[model samples]
Target: MAEQQTWPHHELGRKLNNWGRWGDDDQIGTLNFVTPATRVEAAGLVRTGKSFDLGMPFDKDGPFKAGGFRTNPQHIMTLLPSDTAHTKDGLISADDMIITGLQAATQWDGLAHAGYGGRFYNNVPAAAVNNFLGATRNSFHHAVERLISRGVLLDIARLKGVDRLEDSYEITEADLLAAEERQGVRVRSGDIVLLRTGSYQWFLEGDREHFLGNAPGPCLDTCEWLYEREVAALAIDNHSGEVWPSPIEGVTIPFHQVVIRDMGLTLGEMFNLEELAADCEADGVWEFLFCAPGLKVTGSAGSPITPIALK
Candidate 1:
């Protein structure tokens, strides 16, 4: 892994910081935009009564490698039917257990997932996230009931007439605006935008390495656009939510530092958007009710989510 560069982050952080925008004790950050009225309006989008699952399967074949910083889910059968066959009532059952990283599959990154300048969201000290307690501040549980809202799918790949964007393609603000215009939809405040680069097709085709490396996604320049639009959160169909290989020469994932650390924005990754994209294209409807609540795992940095889009 390369060292993270810290040349322009301080200036950018000051420009887009949301430290006290919500409150001094804020934990959920921009998710505060998903108000009750927005959720009620989003529920009105379900005219066809169709739904799409946007989560990838959790198993050993996921994107992460074994013995790495993160590994795929490991399912173990805790109890077998044969073990209970000696019961006099002839009762038998099977039980299983799953051990995996919270972000091994489709997931939402909590505010504590990234930090810089020795602070988390809302100016929380980075030392709050100790090895013993996971994350004492800005944990995933803070956003559990706040993720329900209208979702807009900006299919950049389809906008460019390609099945998938080229590897390391930097999706710009212009591309996002063009997609919204071409799709005949407009992104509004409090909308959770789902950006589709269509790079997850590589993982679906059994190319985990390709799925995790050099993927196409938003560039650092789009962070200001997101802040200005007041987007509650962003989910993308890729491993990282930004273009790989540090588009800024020496900075690794500068978008994450700006968005997650400074802007206090939540991010979702590894979502399977193919089925949802097909449905939207067929019906010519790009907006839907997106209800994906993270698990109430206190102090956890992130949580796996099986996101659902109802149309």
Candidate 2:
């Protein structure tokens, strides 16, 4: 995306990490800043009561392309036969089920989603997460309650005057500040920052290859920015939260190491923010109420979510 800037930039990210910043046995990491008062403060931003949906549709034609390590969701239905279950006695009933990966569509990555050097977030051992009980440590269960707060959108692609950023275009700290200035907004503590790279619009235009694979996004430097800003969570309209083919050689998804693992930040990916961005620009408001809660699937590493932004 940019120069060969390695992740875990010692000057920035390494110092901003929340490793034990909360406690030695912390489950919800940086989310500790999202108190009840924070939600109350966020609710005040809804002047017009307009809402934006941040979730992509869930189905086979999902974000992940063919032959990836993770595939899209699969739907299955089962028919039941019983004296009290059928419509033959003037009763109509049906049941359906979905068997799919948790993070297949618009989803939230849990504390157990990614790690490095045999350690997950808050020094939770990676082995504790991959066990037979299905991610016993730092699972998505801990995130079931802390997904509501203030939401801010920084439309990087719109700032660059492009429908889509070049694949692997690394977003910089200056770009973030410039976006804030242009939008006339200031990111507050416990804000769920939505970094709109316009990948959602590309996915809408049938550019699946670029949206699913070679999408542009932030680099590790942006993780440092997230940390310094005290953001409660991060959502991006791209595949991975960071740029692909990692900025560092021989280190795949290094941004995951710093953002999710080291900093213990909650990450939301594949959110549909095209309408939200347009509405924000038209209404001259970039801050709103962010709300998205996990399914509370015990031991799961991630879960599908439908985030809503109220303006």
Candidate 3:
């Protein structure tokens, strides 16, 4: 008979030997703007009288879609008198909105989600795992209380000009610099860089077959460059930091593994970049972006986000 493995539960020990390789000689510890947001910003880089939901529209056919083993659920009920309180000038509107579904949109990811032996980013010890329930993807990158500084937008899709980024298309370092030079932008250290590949545009148009098929992503050379520049974090309008079906076979997203796992930095996936790109074009510079994600505790990867840019 085979011996059954017992659940360790809370009895975690030293499982972070692999995490030591992620840090560098000068990688900054604390951040400012990239941290989690708890309240609405009274003053920010951009303002709007109406809230343009960054979240993907939640319908069977909405562009922002997530494939998982489970979905969200919710319920709503209305409270009103039988005759509208018998008044023609009721204070409240006649119709109210009630919505319930999977919590498909949230921002959270802890060390427990990745890393070997359950070690987290920065090599946080296994014993420190708390407030995280379920899986590691729910709590992988938590940069709350950190500050994000100036941002740069690298619009690769516009540089390509096919309306959207196709799957398996590799984004090279040349692509990055060409876009930057074309936009007259310079990438600085400790900056939040958003790479717009236009993948989200197709996803929003109900083109699932193509949307999910494959998309553009960076290669190892570009990743090494960004890491060398000491970027705070890098995000994109695609599923991951690397292209699917990989341009070079026998080498899976070596850049992703090297950056996120070996470099100790973070990554943001599934971002909505249309508006941000447009804002960059109008500004004549593809920089000056500002974004802060919601702090959804006890959750894994956040839902879709619609980051904005300012002039």
Candidate 4:
């Protein structure tokens, strides 16, 4: 029989690393597991042609403040006249410009986005990861390369028989397992896992403060749980992938440091998962073909993405 796989769990300051697992100059982190064969296998999950888009509509009226750390997308028409002639009276065209942050809406957090103890993924300096332009050492280009895979949805709200979990609720390992059993699906290696707290449902209903200020999500406890499973990436409909006012007292989002820093895990946030969950509910299966990758914007900390799930 094949030897059982064991994941080494590390304490804070001491990381469970995949640094040299791929290579010394490896920009892509855990995504190295997503081989070409994985894509072939994942494509088989698409039995029906139905597709679900997991991106929130982005504009000035979206979920972010105007001039905050993260802002809504700003679109401007370059041509003052709608039918500006480019060459002659017969030729006309329209042009526009977008000044927007990559992480403003549904997006993927690049490898250089976060770290702990001043070290980024693979024990590199955080400062070196991003420069005056954008990310350099670990950019969105590397993050987007390994996105096609099997998608798994774990609806925590539906599992708990509620519209949404409590604002401060922390999803535990048991909750994930319960959702898997309830949905008759198991998370596999190279799978992009998405969790739904029904928080997006409230945002869709015009509850912005409750959705942004506080939300239900995972905590530091699941860092090893997901790392051991060898998942390609994780996504959620909430603002932060972890619970707001995190359970770790006197600290803010230690879970982020654990997963993104120590485990080299990429994360996606603000995904619109309401329709996807409803479809999964109707069909008793939570697995599908996930084809969502960050844009190939070189040296970007993150990239806005509209992920699609085909079933």
> Which model is ahead, 1 or 2, in terms of TM-score?
1
Top lDDT: which candidate number?
Answer: 1
For model 2, how does the per-residue alpha-carbon lDDT over 20-82 read when each residue is reduced to its tens digit? 898898977778879999999999988998999899888888867777777888876564445
Backbone clashes, candidate 1: 0
TM-score of 4: 0.92
Highest TM-score: give the candidate number. 1
Off by over 4 Å in 4: 1-15, 80-83, 86-89
RMSD (Cα, Å) of model 3:
7.9
Each model's TM-score?
A: 0.96, 0.92, 0.66, 0.92
Mind giving the per-residue lDDT tens digits that candidate 4 earns over 1-311? 99954323236425456776677788777787788888898899889899999988877767885558988898998875546655666666778888898898888887788876678777777777545767668777876768988889999999999988888789988899899988889887888899998888767888777778878899766776687788878998999878887765566766667777766778889999999999999988799889888689988878899899999
Q: What is the lDDT of candidate 3?
A: 0.53
Q: For residues 105-198, could you state the per-residue lDDT of candidate 3 as single tens digits? A: 2222223333433444455544444555533332433443232445677888888876766667788888988988888877766677788888
In the order shown, the candidates' Cα RMSDs to the true structure are 2.7, 3.8, 7.9, 5.9
Model 1 weakest 10-residue run by lDDT:
4-13
Error of 4 at 55 (Å): 0.3
lDDT of each: 0.91, 0.83, 0.53, 0.81
Number of clashes recorded per candidate: 0, 0, 25, 0
Give the per-residue lDDT of model 1 (tens digit) for 1-311.
99965567657778999999988989988898899999999999999899999999988878998778999999999999999999999999999999999999999998999887798888989899999988999998989998999999999999999999999999999999999899999988899999999999999999989999999999877888899999999999999988987778757888888888888889999999999999889989999999999789989999999999999
lDDT of 4 at 291: 88
